[model samples]
Target chain A: MPNPDAGGHWGEFGGRFVPEALIAALDELEAAHTAALADPAFMSELDALGREYGNLPSPLYLAERLSEEAGVEVWLKREDLNHTGAHKIRNVLGQALLTRRMGKTRIIAETGAGQHGVASATAAAYFGLECTVYMGEEDTRRQALNVARMRLLGAEVVPVTTGSRTLKDAMNEALREWVASVEHTHYLIGSVGGPHPFPMLVRDYCRGIGDEARAQFLERTGALPDVVAACVGGGSNAMGIFTAFLDDASVKLYGFEAGGDGYGTGRHAATITAGQIGVLHGARTFVLQDEDGQTIESHSISAGLDYPGVGPEHAHLAASGRAAYEPVDDAEAMAALEKLARTEGIICAIESAHGLAGALRLAKSLEPGARVLVNLSGRGDKDMGNVVEYFDFADRKGQQG
Target chain B: MRAEAAFATTRAEGRAALVGYLPAGFPTLADSIKAVDIMIDHGADLIELGLPYSDPVMDGPAIQRAADQALAAGFRTRQVFEVTEAVAGRVPILVMTYWNLVERYGVDRFARDFKAAGGAGLITPDLIPDEAGEWIAASDEHDLDRVFLVAPSSTEERIASTVAACRGFVYAQSVMGVTGARAATSAAAPELVRRTRAHTDLPVGVGLGVRSGDQAAEIAAYGDAVIVGSAIVNCYLDSEDVPAGHQRLAALTADLAAGVRR
Candidate 1:
């Protein structure tokens, strides 16, 4: 794993930029995480849970049709097939285990698309811990199905109406809730963002994606893929799949951020693409902000990627030139989603479609035999409503011949 | 006026200092200045002029509403200095803000500008001592007090380091929550204050609660200063007009000052 410094400084991008009240809780969490990693029992238990509950080693499949279209080999790391239909379960399971280790009885999570909230709720149900998921009021309206799923799994869904009423606001409310209830509650951050230990911890938990894929690809192809791509909303999935490739100098890493409309429209969540370095949520990262440092509201058709800030490690990677981040606008991402569904019989989330879109573009530029690996981070079951709206499925409902 | 002088004067009077807070441009810039004028006239010994930012995670609805209004009225980072300049000699004005604003404004530039405005110092709620190296250097270079906070949940080691880094009075979050006024004061404040007292001789200002005069009196009994934010902001939020807000703000400040002195 690419560990941050002792203070969780990922090249001056990540640190404890939170209220002093959260310091003790963060310290305790870090200690518990360190102890948990060192303990064989904890590691084995987590591994066992990952295998049994998450259905580990989600397939690595070669996409012949996609490859034919792009004139380059494309491999899909099928995180979409995991339990909860996403890669989110991996991080949730790890944090839930740690919460149990710390003797916490309740877990609170902030969700934008509700994928993480559903995964957290599922884990909370499994562990019999009280779960409360804070979601943006706008997101609740957008991802209503996931809201129902979380509630059905015994989690209270709180609609945060504060500040822009989106993913960032949801996180703000979750942090506020964690402050008052830190004694017995764990703030199960959904992404690899926030202050110390969180980006590192979440990345560590999700690294199984890259670990499994790298070994699987090596065994199948006898060489590493030329490129690795993933969507970068708070950057957990990207970090998850990018960690194993950091040492592989030959492998190019591409992070596709949500480009809501287009770059020039002033309506997008392409933080690294068009943003300044500032602090948001907790981590010092690339942020969409006004001239005075106020966080500017980011827009995206993908609710999950509609956040103003990218993860700190991503910022470091972008700065150090280890990884390249690009904007994949909504139309292009949705087109990629439709292409995958039509050609491969696989419908991936709009967030994951961004990675696919970027990968396809990269493949088109590469030689025919060069292979690109795309982390299909989640299935599109939760995004059907959006897909319908975006593709105008309503207009053709009865006209399908 | 500086923080030390404010505390020293309060100590000489054998009373806790009354620290009042308001977002610098809430309602409007002119009205905000008028409101501060009313507060200083009513008995506010120190002013925590809040710089309105978009994401204030540490604040609750009362402060959030006011901050939102301030931003809606187009409050920017430089206006914090404008407010500080207007209210500087009246009281020690410490800009209570999130760390990002100062960083976005350029740490050295922010310190230089704030000091140039005749402001006392800063009360950064989010910037802890561990990540405050640049800020510490800048504050010291500018001869400004850097106030960091200790919460009820803060460890003794954390408190020691936090207070050691603080040049102004140490800020103590009486509760383990965002800033708001509660019907009851923190049962945890007295103990947290006691722990913080063990580490630093600086006056510890307890915040995150204390809405009423009685609550201020309760905190003042043990803490060196009674920090009232949302209560005073609440008066403005609940008022029918700007003048009414000023009137209620003054009344609340007077009541809390009297309670702190008692």
Candidate 2:
């Protein structure tokens, strides 16, 4: 197991590779991050915000039904219960506070499924700063409800039409906007990807989940779980939980990637499970790219899990064998979603179902008493349409002809 | 102001002649030409006619928007050559561009047509030095000065190698970042100029974030020539019409040139 304060370089996976236009912004972020690490005043400010605004220290609930079904003891760290209904608010609040400290007046963010946009808008509203979000035209059309949510939250949503019309296009649009407004606007990147300080900073803010979970788990179970499971999209949620348990050699960490159809079909966003080491976005990470280094289109039933690249820190974790990555196909994840909805009445997002599915499979292979902790990354409220459509539940109920 | 004599003199000066940059087809090609004429009129010595690419990574938003507008108006490689040819060697023209447009245009034909159009130099902002040797040789055959940029992050050995292969004055990026106009010049520009001077006697002109007359004057104290780009492009954005834009630019350049001379 590696040390926690290891400068966010999982091994050689995380480093800054941004355009020259962003050097100043990145440098300022790095400097502020360094200062915040040592300054108790900055730390306490974030702590207060987490408690008052973000509803920090979310509970680690023992999933008695899930454990009984899987024949293993299972627990969940409920990050989906956060203020923004996902883990994204944790990072956004921290970054928004830092933006105020830097004297910046504007905030810009790019979103795929609009979770990050909602979180960023929430932060901007709290801080009284102007906010703008760039989302791909395709995503905007598919996630119309989230777009309306952002608008209602007082953040302008600009639809990007370039590239593949997905998260990649939104990112390119955001980069263009950042280059133009580099002076007074801070780009609030959503996940543990992009350049150096971003992955490090987002991970630092979200690490509270793992820290609290570790202490709570010890108090309840008398020891850490044998395995920790979390779904890896941009890997923020997984890294947040894994960071605290990285040094616990007895605990095995598993990250489940979206295997759209399956790794064999080659249409998945399972970068760690199916990709080679390469560069994308800004960091050197495992990416689904061709020989010429062009990014390939990825597929997933879940829009949030359709990105072609994973966080650089996840790449490092995969490389060092500190973490094991497995892919959960569309069918399997969908099944897990239904299983949780029926068993526990907790409708989990299709993305979070990847972790749920992985936990079930791992439980089947392990001793009946072995404990597993799954980071239930988000709720299924945003994904109800996809679940209903994929399962044809309304048609079976005779609600549709 | 003929390009042949300017190239010959530039070679004799033991330094690359300064090629001032102004976005082509910006405001309008008609007024863009006047801005070019104004640069040549005020001892610009050489000129870089920027053929705006859709994705200009090395450029700031102001220049990027200018390029986007130029592109939106159907500004292609052939139009860039036609515009330069219209100048008729009043000053040497270098087509600064992204490689994708050049690849689409066919590099050999693009090189030949560019030189035949009274152009005397070429600068590819995105070309890495390791991959530029073949193009450098091709440009030499066509008798075009190949300009290159040196940054703060470039290693000393890489700088020497690139400078030795380079034909025109080395473009000294004043800051560690991309092309933009700033309220003030970068504090690092002086040290960067000093470091560039140590390796090659090529007249180093500092660019990126140079916006005002006072900053140009300060840079001119150390640099052999000061390169102002984003400021001039932003001036075009400020005006409603092309001729009005060119008139504004001419006045601004004259003031900046005077400060540089002082």
Candidate 3:
């Protein structure tokens, strides 16, 4: 299979489709990216930052119980253990370093579940750059702890009230703020969406996870995993892992999208699974839009997975059949969340649980000796309350024999 | 004297032409159409009708606010074309818009409808020449001129490439940023104009900050066209009523057009 990034597009997707306000910024980023790719000094600086600040080379752990239960060997890429407790720190560190290199004084970001906000705040604190995070009012209320955490790190958290009062609205507010302050501020987008150079740049920064994981998996198993699975929201983690393995024909890539109830219910974030190819968030990608082309509301138990669009690379991967996408329902993901906690003693984010659930289903259909790798995208610490409340886990635990 | 005659005479003297920009339906759709007729009646050889977007990222606060107001007043893509259709090709009409709206409206349909509405061209401020392949075919199919912008920061290589891809004329941004009226034009604009002229035979029109008659004259002296956008947009904002707004825009357009020939 050809590398989708060959045409500077991810399979006829992911071009710089932005307003003129961002042209200069994107151009500057493109120049810096070109320089950084060629300059060993720049690479070394980013390497040092990743090592010291982002806690690079996150572990790849074999899930013994999960493997036994599924009758297949399962390995987990432990991005959940990274600093700030998620994979977001990887991109944030890279961008914050780039911001400093560009001599920008401030950073602005948008958050849905506040993982990106926390990561941005952490990076801002490390770099001593003033940071402002725009979060939808509903998200601020739901993720109050992360909001406090950002404020504690000296970053301002502004509640955005527009559109649907969610991640999309927050993103719009951040874009508006960036437009207003393009001279000295960098808008640190959280995921692998948005205009050119961003999707490519963010993917490059986060690809370290897959790079390290592939090597680690090969070292441990003496062969590549039959399938690599990760949950896809804006598809940052999935793209991170899938990109490195794109050229490996034998390795199957799977992206699990959130199916709130079911794809037929028209209330899921199963963009690649149910959406048609359309332009959204500055790139041509799969979007869950109505027949009239109006973007429809998407729902998920996890706030992070409630976006109506998927990253462009994911769309390309799915279209080319290099990657398979499946939607995981709320119940299935919650069940996987609990199962992982009890079996592996690792509490995974509800978003990541979708991957685990997908892996379990895939394991059932595969050969008994098949090996699979699931990207444990984040820890479930941020979602403990919701998990407990939604599943009645407290009562269920007491009722357990 | 007719505005077309003034422009023709200036072109015969090897002088640049003059283009004017007005937000489609600035004070009202009727007022905006009246302003367009007035500008063409006075001197605007080519007119850029800015399709107001909810988020006009490239525009400064004034233009952004004006766009927001226009959108609130039920301005839309179809309505802009409707206004163009009413004008009936008295002059070339260029639709200036952000790329998202263009993508959403379907580039092929937009190009077809725009041409069918008597529009001569389209100026996608955000669309880079390198990424314009898909829309280029659509524009060609519809026989609409695809105008590209060249900024001060554009490299020589990019300038040549963009100029080659562009039809009609190349919009030369006078400054680094977006559309807004400025107290004075950039000192580097004339040199930029000269540099752009060396690269392409296409007419180069300077935009982004031309607000006064003096600035228009200064730019027209060096370039193939001088574009004044925000100053004209401000004229409508300053008026208390639609009639007053149209009258103000007409008088301002005549004054600016006269300045180019002086």
Could you say which candidate leads in DockQ? Answer: 1
- What are the chain A TM-scores of the candidates, in order? 0.98, 0.96, 0.96
Classified by CAPRI criteria, candidate 2 counts as: incorrect
Q: Which stretches of candidate 2 lie over 4 Å from their true place?
A: A1-10, A395-401, B1-262
Of candidates 3 and 2, the better by TM-score: 3
The deviation in Å at residue A256 for candidate 2 is: 1.1
lDDT at position B125, candidate 2: 64
Task: Tell me the spans in candidate 1 whose CA falls farther than 4 Å from its real position.
Answer: A395-401
lDDT of 2 by residue, B1-262 (tens): 2344664664565433444687778767676777788777766666778887654556776787787687667665677887788765666677777654564566777888887887877776655454455577778788777767766655666567667766666777777556788888878778877887788876677788877677777877787667778888877788877767777777777777666656
Clashing pairs in model 3?
none
Give DockQ: model 2.
0.08
- Candidate 2 has an lDDT of 0.78
Residue-level error in angstroms, candidate 1, position B210: 1.0
Candidates' chain B TM-scores in the order shown:
0.98, 0.90, 0.93
Can you write out model 1's per-residue Cα lDDT over B73-159, one digit (the tens) per residue?
A: 888899888888887897888999998899999999999999999998999988988888899999989999889999888888889
Most TM-score-accurate candidate? 1
lDDT of each: 0.91, 0.78, 0.82
- lDDT by residue (tens digit), candidate 3, B1-262: 1124334555787766778887786767787788888888887777888887654546665676677677668776788888888775677788888775677778898888888888877888878877788789998888778888877666677778888888878888777666788988888687777878888877788888877677778887888788888888888778787777778777787777776777
The full ranking of all candidates by TM-score, starting with the best, is 1, 3, 2
TM-score of each: 0.98, 0.70, 0.82
DockQ of all candidate complexes: 0.90, 0.08, 0.20
